[model samples]
Target: MTEVFSSNSELVLQRSVDINLSDSGSRHEDIRELYQISETCAFITSNNYKKVALQFPDELLVDCVAVSAALEKETNAKTYILGDTTYGSCCVDEVAAEHVGADCIVHYGRSCLSPSRRLPLMYVFGKRPINVQECAAAFRELYPDQESHVIILYDVTYSHAIDDLQRLLGDTYPNVVFSVLRADHSHGHACEPFKVRTNSDCQDDTFVHKFGRRFTLTNFMMTWNRCSFCSFNPDTSTGRAESININKALMKRYYAIERAKDASVVGILVGTLGVANYLNIIEQLKESIRKVGKKSYMFAMGKINVPKLANFLEIDVYVLVACPENSLLDSGEFYRPVVTPFEMETACNKHREWSGEYITDFQDLLPGGSSHVDFTESDHSTNDDTTDVSLITGALRSSCLRSSPEPTDGSSSSSSVVVRNQTLTMANTNAAASFLSGRSWQGLERKLGEAPVVKAVEGKRGIAIAYEEEGTERKDSACPDHKNLNYRKQSGV
Candidate 1:
């Protein structure tokens, strides 16, 4: 009895090894590396078989084929796969069972469903007919003592099988889980599904609280997969939301600055596809700015294939939302600005509060849209003086220690200027401000502050002075008493 149990266990392990050897890819390489150092078990499919098979060197392939053949010949190893056998590391089953004389073969596919005499003959002589549910249940039963973790891998076509497996393994088995692997697999060929295997102990309380309540009893598991893995993962939905929030905050700050005095309308342009979802939010942001007495504009640009419902009313900005592919095909050129998600996030966070040259390149992709203003040209100007003063003063005010400089000549007409020779000093101040405000300053503040300072020359149009703040010598071109100035002097004030 002990020998029989040992043989069966070795056979199962050998089958697993064969499957791993057959399916090799970048992911499989990682799996192989992981298995080398840990007790890892892989659950692969025919879809991923090609990828997995390519990972093994030619020498290893020969070794695997020979080992597989020997194991099938020596043991009662039953090979059961749930897809077309024409593909997947070819000749493994034939060479193993026939050449080496293996025990059993179980191939399940659409052709096996026929009621013809050949179908029954194949069922009795070659393979067994088992539904996906029955296969999953059998695996569960076979490893009753082992803490088996089952992942139901299926494509969009066999989504029904996923549902069936989920229903079969419900609350009855706490360890069992289901995941829909989204991939296009044609003709029931063996394909590997992208598996997002979350450890059972890693409970997402916030996810459960938010999406769990919305899950229906009939589709609880399916909905849970959609929410946790598909829609709401931080890499996908949450990241997009963060971008919107950052943009809104920046737009609000821009409005507040403009509202202090009338500034020219600055258009907000958002790209399509991934960034288009924030169109409504950007419009709302413009409205919020308008309410605060600021002139603002908005432009959404992307492919025409983008949904038409993304229209916004009462926005001063021109929106050119359309598809890049269409634009390229129509005009014999592909012209679309691709902004990194990180850049979008940074633009949103610092757009409003930090005063510097703000230019989003997505604006240029729109039809009849002008190129984005160069940051080098805009940052060189002294227009950000008031903005800098406000940032500095705000920082001082928060600490309850007024850093506002007294007028050197006691002239209210004179502008107060803050200048730091070293970019690090400005960076430190900006970081300190962000830390104090409990909000990130976006990339604008960091870049602006870290930029090398060009000292104002003598007889220059603007005032030049160096003031000591927080043990650092800061230089500025703005007059010391010009704190109340609405716009920076360089912005054509």
Candidate 2:
């Protein structure tokens, strides 16, 4: 019998491969040139971090052990190869890092720039070669003369391409603006896409802005894909830049939810585990569904694909809770509608209007956000198993609820109780509401400075403040700060 310590952390071997790194021809070249090798080793060596966990995605996992050993030898650091992530590999695996007492995580491949609470992260976005000269040539040729400020946004993997494009375009189009969009590395915050800057140093009055988001381009003179750096015009059957019709793009997102609002059983798909505070957001989602008076079941899977999701035919819609890059999945080819939590909120809540503004970052939807968009319950009621109950009840299912849609089997009775003495679980929206209303506590990772510190207030409900000091003004029942109540402390009130 092999020695396997814990069931949860057991290493499941599919098959074994025996190959020498030095002996292999093309494989040796490929593995030797694993992106940013010198820089990564130097960082580890300089920092003197003894134990490091190297996280690799499936695509880059080919040289996992080889790279890990190399790092170990070069930096004299103990390296742990983390293959299977609990959530999306884009986020840091605090769980895996803590398992091995790793001082830092050397994350390989794509990253969502998700805040890491415990383990400090070092990202190595493996360099993927792109046709930078060709893309720059296409940009100069196809772009309309009217438009000037061109903000080139791309994934970090294509950082090499952006660097090259910036150099080549500077010679001809001196006035045209270009920015290599960098991910916001600020802890506990998602950065904005645009910033109009008027540099006083420059002689011209041209405005510059940075974009870190991706969009599909079509039906215009120019279109560009952020990931592949491929620019195209789908309508004219020619290729160049991206043309985004703001109104149309917004409407398309809105319409997807209209289809989702018609779903009965909504599935909450967990897309990222590596991101800090994912569990908190999932809890918030369940509560939102409860408030809307709908049935919500959560599915936690590593990689989301079509066939894996098709197993749950009962769910009419899927709300993907993932990183900004991976969250908004296309639902056109899927069996049913798949949308983000923000879309899920718009679809289920009656009072929440879709005014074309969309949110990709889940952090914005966090329950206690300062600018959290409040949504009122819908009174609409639906007896149809395929439709969302909240859209039907208008949140009318408070105590005595009624559904309008007839049973699918041609039941003569319109009453929600039964068609022919058949009791449905979803029929009692109130019951489902109560069942889905609680939040489970997963351990949170907050900085020492950021973590909330609780203090016993004499005359009012217990209060917690980020900074705990005796001299600092203490919040009391009469203080203005008292208006903000800690909902966590409330016992069913």
Candidate 3:
């Protein structure tokens, strides 16, 4: 590929990685391998889409223009470049495509491949070369205790080199088990050989059938959901030993969901704007929250991190609705609980009993064969009968709230009000404690009304203020003590 940089080019963000820009535009190894021209051409030709939207993640922006120019020339289609996504780049930028009326999106770099609702999407997971010979040799040296059948696993970016890896390993390890990820052709993201740690050994029709039925993220461990991804059967003697790792992963997720039960406010982190059918998922989430009577806030951000979310102190938990791959944001590191949509359902939905089913893809959380949540006829028609009536209904205070406690040097008056509010908050806290104290919520407190509330005790000056409920009328006198009047003036209170 040629070094086609216009006058106004995006400045290089990182120094380590650089795309070798060619002079004559014939194409060099670095650019050609990263951007597969043949496959891209075939995809564009077959799709018959005219105006293509080329969406690139931040890291791949350097090669975006060069790749776009090539696609336009080969396919004779007008190209529009889309910048920073509102959510995680692994999600398709469906929001950005509306601006240019894009016929379809050619997404480059990391993607979760969530089913899109509107425009079709194609993923170009740029090829990153891996030394298959060295890796396999290292693997053989590392684990000698295991049987000859070793599950070859890797990140999806290095998936292109899996074949080369298998060939090198074939010499020593005769029974090398490899898994293949078949595409759901319904969405435009059907770029082949999408190996998320597995690819078809491409042996025969019998081999594929014997190994698997439907390759699905839904019902991850169903009877039909074959361990064909890997030949090691957990039921058999060999399968039992390998199953330990899978068990640990599921347990970790289960505990994470359990921890979310104590959370007061839930922050819905919109991880993908480009993903197709997020609106439906969000509705289900809001209704779920409503059913549980927990407050929900939605946030749409480009790059999500601890600092970005730390600003919202009130939010007790966060649920990321991004693509499954990008959503692996470690829960261990975050200050608060960060869970997936499926995990949120586990946490909030009372009837949703856990059966050790781990589903990262949000679509899998839906009912039946569809890609999204399917609410029943009863769910759609029926009104929410249960109204979450707050237990403490009338007011937060023990006595009637006054407009002003007879103003006396603004701070004292405001501070007195603050103290009263604090008193009410304490009462409310106590009320809430009692509200959840017993099996019947001790309906006693709700029926009997406010408890003996704590009121802030007035001090002469610079003295420790104690909380008391007695002598309420005597303290109501707004007239300042003449002795403290001069003191109050000097102290500027």
TM-score preference between candidates 1 and 3, better one: 3
> Candidate 1 overall Cα lDDT vs. reference?
0.29
Backbone collision count in every prediction? 41, 20, 8
Worst 10 residues of 3 by lDDT: 205-214
| Candidate ranking (lDDT, best to worst) | 2, 3, 1
Q: What are the per-residue Cα lDDT tens digits for candidate 2 across 1-493?
A: 2233233323345554453332222253465465556777877787778998888876667678778777777788898989878766667787788899988887776566666567666777755545655565556665534345444545555555555667787666656655433345442112233232335332223222212223322211111212123243212223433344545666677777865666656788988766767788787777666554466788987677676777665677889987766776667667767888888877655566776456777787776753256653244444222232344335522322234344588764323355335563435343334434543533454445554556544333334443233344455557655433333422222
lDDT tens string, model 3, 1-493?
1132232233534345433332112343555557776677777788888788888776677677888877877887788888677776666787788789888888876555566777876777766444555555555554443344444444345557768767876676655565554665676755433343434423221111111111222223321222423322111212111232545567777767765555557888887775655666776776575445465778876678766676665677888887766664566656677888877887666466777645666765655433334322343223333322222232231111122235554564322124446346322232223335544533434323334444445445321232233332233345433223112221112
* CA-lDDT, candidates in order: 0.29, 0.59, 0.57
Superposed by TM-score, candidate 3 places the C-alpha of residue 478 at a distance from the truth, in angstroms, of: 58
> Candidate 2, 253: how far from true, in Å?
3.4
User: Which pairs of residues clash in candidate 3, taking residues 3 or more apart in a chain or in different chains?
Assistant: 1-27, 92-274, 93-274, 94-274, 116-276, 117-276, 179-199, 233-239
Q: How far off is residue 347 in model 3, in Å?
A: 2.2
TM-score per candidate, chains pooled: 0.20, 0.58, 0.55
Quick one: RMSD of model 2? 22.6
Off by over 4 Å in 1: 1-158, 171-279, 285-346, 350-493
